[model samples]
Target chain A: MTLNTWIDLVYLLAAIGFILALKGLSSPKHARNGNLLGAAAAAVAIGFTFAYPEVRAHTLNLVLTLVAMAIGAAIAVPAARMVKMTAMPQMVAIFNGVGGGAAALISIVVFLLEAPGKPAVYRIAEVLFGVLVGSVSFSGSAIAFAKLQELMTGRPITYPAQQAINAVVGVTIVALAVGTLVTGNVPLLVATAVLSLVLGVIFVLPIGGADVPVLISLLNSFTGLAVAASGFTLNNNLLIIAGTLVGASGILLTRMMSKAMGRSLANVLFSAFGSVVTAAGGADGSAESRPVKAGTPEDIGVLLAYARKVVIIPGYGLAVAQAQHTARELADLLMERGVEVFYAIHPVAGRMPGHMNVLLAEANVPYDELKEMDEANPEMSTADVALVIGANDTVNPAAKNTPGSPIYGMPIINADDAENIVFLKRSMRPGFAGIDNELLFDEKTTLLFGDAKDTLAKLVAAVKDA
Target chain B: MSTGILEFLTIFVLAALVGNEVIGRVPSILHTPLMSGSNAIHGIVLVGAILVMGSASGAMQVTLAFLAVLLATLNIVGGFVVTDRMLEMFKPKPVERAPKASDASGDDATGSPK
Candidate 1:
């Protein structure tokens, strides 16, 4: 197969664009643009690929492709629109899995076509990779998706015989792949596919849900390499380049995700820990958090009107209820009353670090108004009213002293030290770490049992009325 | 030389290993910012996949390339949109204008300073 200089140049430009996008995405400020630049490059690459003589022959398949494309676009567009940002990792995994399946299928079809007898060893390598990586990526990703979506529990499904059986299957698959290489026995190829498929499922089965993102990213990298190997088999430059990029990027992303979660990638993959799904019926467990007796919205308004200072502590509950806007409104009301209003943000308050910041920033909370835990904790002791909105563990007193807890020894804001505490939580349920919060039971604390968004809305209305 | 490919492999492996270490140090406090920041890399992945697809031959290459492009696009676009929505969470409001001391029953029946 001959390669054209123009096509190579276009591919090189796309590669440069990818590099730029990756570098730009290192920070939030440039993330959006990074996406656009990368996307534009991809568009160029796609257009060039279709210019090839081989693919242009499918002139009539255009109509079927268009119809299918439209159907996919409609479903994907809405799903992409509706899915919360938190679930983006899972979505990426599902899509990556599909890519892997496609790469594997490509090689299978190419092998079936009967290649001219040359580069026998290289062909063998490609076939082994296409079968192994593609199969694992496909099934492993599907299981990861299931765990993320709660279709399967987040806990590791540990079976004593599991790893042993996987080893046996893994060896068998390798043997078949090698066998097919030596003598293109279709039976060996089929066996290789089946073994790989099962290996994919088993590989991801023990990966706990909490670590699904890492697995997804890693699998994604596998998909890229699979495609790259397939590209070599097909003797396509664009395929090799693009596959290399995806493979490389996926590997990098997986590492980054693992770091963010404070676990090693190896730990995530090999350990049968991390997935701790407490029952959901406990969703309303905040019943014990009954706010200083159920005070009417108007009563809270009365307190806010008289308060000399009111500080709001925002948490994942705040993010979950999507109440940042209303909280800001309440803050404005407090400010107008000659009350000093500040937002106390904990590092790990929401699902991820800086989660609260992103949410608050979205609500246009001034960077100065948001106080870090160290900054906020000192103020809470003196504040007249500490309005805790949907925060749990970061404000929990246990983390400060309990070394046995998962979040033990982690620094937390001293919301319990405040003059008068008002906790706005739906119930007394524990946070993601699956541990109870003693702060909810504090004597000075007022547990307002309701959705953070609704309760905050009521508070805003009452403040306005007052 | 085959050594060039080996060098590239080394760099790739190093990036992945280093990236993992860096992300592990990320406290949950940095979760949102971290994802937003790293998603830029995910975009790069998408672009890389697209470039690959453009040169890929056979039906399978076509499919993998397109699929990678689509998913990565969704991640980039969706990530930004969601971040915008989340910002709505912290918008400031008007200051509290009234001052009243209400009791436990929540019934503020008394009319105070107008």
Candidate 2:
């Protein structure tokens, strides 16, 4: 077979490997295998590409490519191993963003190579689209990483005429894209990329922290589309297949995340939810005006030890405190005392869907005991104790009771229904969305104030004494 | 080239539909890992980066392609490594008394809760 034929076969095999990887990832039993399959596929693809006659002819390029891959591996391996479970979302965002950056760069280089000769308008359009989407994904993901890392405020950064400015920027980018296609202007292309980057920042800036996971998912899809565009510019079949798959899967995941929050994708992006509050009338005034029961670790320990059943609710605060293992220790102690223990996980808990589960799993928590909201709510009212561990908004009754509240209509765990409720909190601070939790003021609720890990340690000690 | 772009569009659309169905059945518990896994796949853009880098004729094009290769490699390496790390955590525990891997190490340093 000719060298091109060999390359084609390798690409075909690599595409199949990616498909198998995706299929395997959907199930826990096969997830590790899926990841390995992807890695092997990548190795094979890179190897075959290196052996291509054109690539082999470029000796300097070959050395640089190999060195780049090595450097990338050197940086990535340690970083991946060292990152805390809580920071996984941020890490994913950064890694995915770099891919988008690479795609944008690829578009620029390809455009420069083709533009001097008056390349076909369709080809120019494809290159422009790649640059546009790739730039947006890169910049948008940076904002997301900043938000997740708390390097910037998690609340939506909104100003006057925010959406209007974004709209104008959007129109300008489209115009520049068309101009580049018509005139084949490199400067216009560069301007389009820079403006698209600005557009990404603008696109994500007004979105509140609560909706960031959806945004991340959406940006991930954008990167996939960008990669696919690059694939078209190169006329590479494997890039088209793999990039499109990722793009599609990302869109689906974004939709699922939106559904889990009981919001539409448009609403999540444009809601400006954190900045606005609604005035609502209710029997329980506001969270600040109402009083709450306060308790110590000793009181909590006694309540938990004597309870017939306890359901634990975890949120981002738990992840922030790095307290998953401590929480699990407390639960194991309760279980040893013959008290039934199960975790009640809110769908939108932590930074993303299934985030709490991943953290808990890392702590060796049994998979069967971690229950979703729907499954856990029915058992909550019957449970003797509801342990709210560094979690607030998900348990708030306002989601169900007050239609005017920001998080109203969002599904939440019915933690308030338990006969007794105890909250481990740092203070009276609201959650990421900055909405005061109505659950804090419930008559049966007892606030145990402290850092999550420290408070959990205290509970474990107190439980032993009890 | 226009015909190539048209053919590319067809592939793009069909692959997207196929992708949607492929991931449609994933349960919520696996979503985080699944997202990370697919995120790694986008690293396939490294192929384009290499192609651009290898074929460029001038210094400017070479520099751009070099940056593309560097960044795409980062995406590929970091994406896959991080994804594998996460997926490793999701492995099903052996039914029989499986030895605690991470938690056991946590225990030796901090000891048990009691």
Candidate 3:
């Protein structure tokens, strides 16, 4: 077979491989094999590309490609191996950003190589789109990684006219894009890329940390679109197919994430851009002045030991304190006493969807015991004791009770409906959304103040003694 | 080339529809791995990098192509490996080891679980 035919065949196989990978990824049982298939496809694609006649003709470039692959593996292997599960989101952000940056660079190089006024308008447009979207994904993802890693404050950082400033930057990028196409100015193209990167950073700065999962998915979509545009420039079929697949899925994921948060995509992206309006719950002086029922480890232990049914609510703070095992141990203790135990997990409980489930899974929590928000809410009413571990916003009553509250539309675990509520928290501070949990001040709720791990250990000991 | 572009457009639209349908049914539990998994798919841009590198005519073009190849490789390799690691953890253990009566004894051994 001719070299071109071989490349085409390999691309076809790779496309099929990726499709099966996604299908397999949908279920845990097949996820590992799906990943392996993708890796094998990538290997085939990369290996065949090296055997192409064009590549063979340029020995120096071939060496460079090999060296580049080596460097990539050198960094990727160790980073992926060593990163903690808690930091997985940031890892995804950085890796996805590099993919975007790569696409942008390819567009720049293509534009630089094109002879002046020789390319078709459609080709120029594709390159322009590729550079713009790719640059945005790169810098936007960098900012996201920084926020999630706590390199900077997780709160939304805004200033007066932040959106106005961003709008101006957006307009400048569009103008530069047009200029690059009309005049075939390489410098203008470079300037457009730089401006787009700045725009990406500005775009993400005002989105508070709580909404980062949505932002990451959004940026993932942008990178996918950018790759498709890059494929258009290169006239590659498999690239177009794979890229568009990612683009579509990423978009759907982003929308789902926002819906889960009970916020519109528009509001999540822009509402926090201007003056950060303190939510009504945060501003109301009621939460502070309300008499809070505080409980010690022994009190919580006694309550849990006597309860017939206990529901555990786990959240981001549980992951932050790395207390999944301790929480599980306490649950085990309850189960030994013949008290039923179930874990209630909110869809958007942790940094990412299903984040709490993964943490609980690592602790060997039984799959049957982990309940989705819808499944767990009904049981909350029947549960004799609701043990909340480092979770606030998801269980807050304001989501259903206060119309003026920012989180009013969000679906929460019905912890308030339970007979007794015990919250293991570090302090009276609000959750990621900067709003106090009104449930903390409820008459039935008792706060157990300490680190989640320490408090859970104490609770375990208390339950054992009781 | 125009015919090629049209064919590409057709494939792009079809793939997008397929992506939306396939991903719509994915359970929330696998969303993170799915995101990272698809993140690897776009790394197919490495093909473009290879083509660019092959035809690179100058020092500058070569440098840009090299970086593109490097970044794309990172996305592909890092994305797939990390996803596999995550999915592996999701697998159920052979036995749900009930929290032992001496659970505290194992605390030091499993210290820093992350």
Candidate 1, superposed: residue stretches over 4 Å from native? A1-3, A60-71, A84-89, A107-119, A134-137, A154-263, A266-311, A338-340, A344-356, A371-386, A393-421, A433-435, A462-466, B1-114
As for DockQ, the candidate ahead, 2 or 3, is 3
lDDT of 3 by residue, A118-155 (tens): 67777889999999999999999999999999898676
**DockQ ranking of the models:** 3, 2, 1
**Model 2 DockQ vs. reference:** 0.56
Give the per-residue lDDT digits (tens) of candidate 1, residues A1-466. 3546676678668656755555444444454565566557766765675555544455433333334345544555576567665565566566566667666655655565544353365566676687678778888888988887778766566666776787899888878888887887666776798789899998888765545656766776787677666666665544565566556655666666565444567766876533233222224556554554555667777777688878888887887787877787677667766789899887656654565776676555667788877788778878888888887766777767654444445567788777777888887666654466766666776667799878877887787688
On the 0 to 100 scale, the lDDT of residue A59 in model 1 is 47
Q: Is candidate 1 or candidate 3 better by TM-score?
A: 3
lDDT of 2 by residue, A1-466 (tens): 9888989899989998998999898887888899899989988998788766666667887788778878887888788889987788889998888889999999999899988899888789889989999999999999999998889977777776776788899999989998998999999999999999999898888777777888888888889999998998899999989999999988998888888888888878876733443422221335565677899899889999999999999988898888888887788778777899999998878887888888787777878888999899999889999999887778878889977665677788998889999999998877776677777877888999988999998998898789
Quick one: best DockQ, which candidate? Answer: 3
TM, chain A, every candidate = 0.77, 0.94, 0.94
Which digits, one per residue and each the tens of the lDDT, describe model 3 over residues B17-106?
988887656678888888888898788788888888888878989999999999998988899888887887786553355465566436
Candidate 3's displacement at residue B80, Å, is: 0.9
Model 2 misplaced stretches (Cα beyond 4 Å): A273-291, B1-3, B94-114
B1-114: candidate 1 lDDT, tens digit per residue? 355445445544554443344333333333443343333223333333433443455675456445545544454444334433333333344223234433211222221111
Model 1, C-alpha of A350: deviation from truth (Å):
4.7
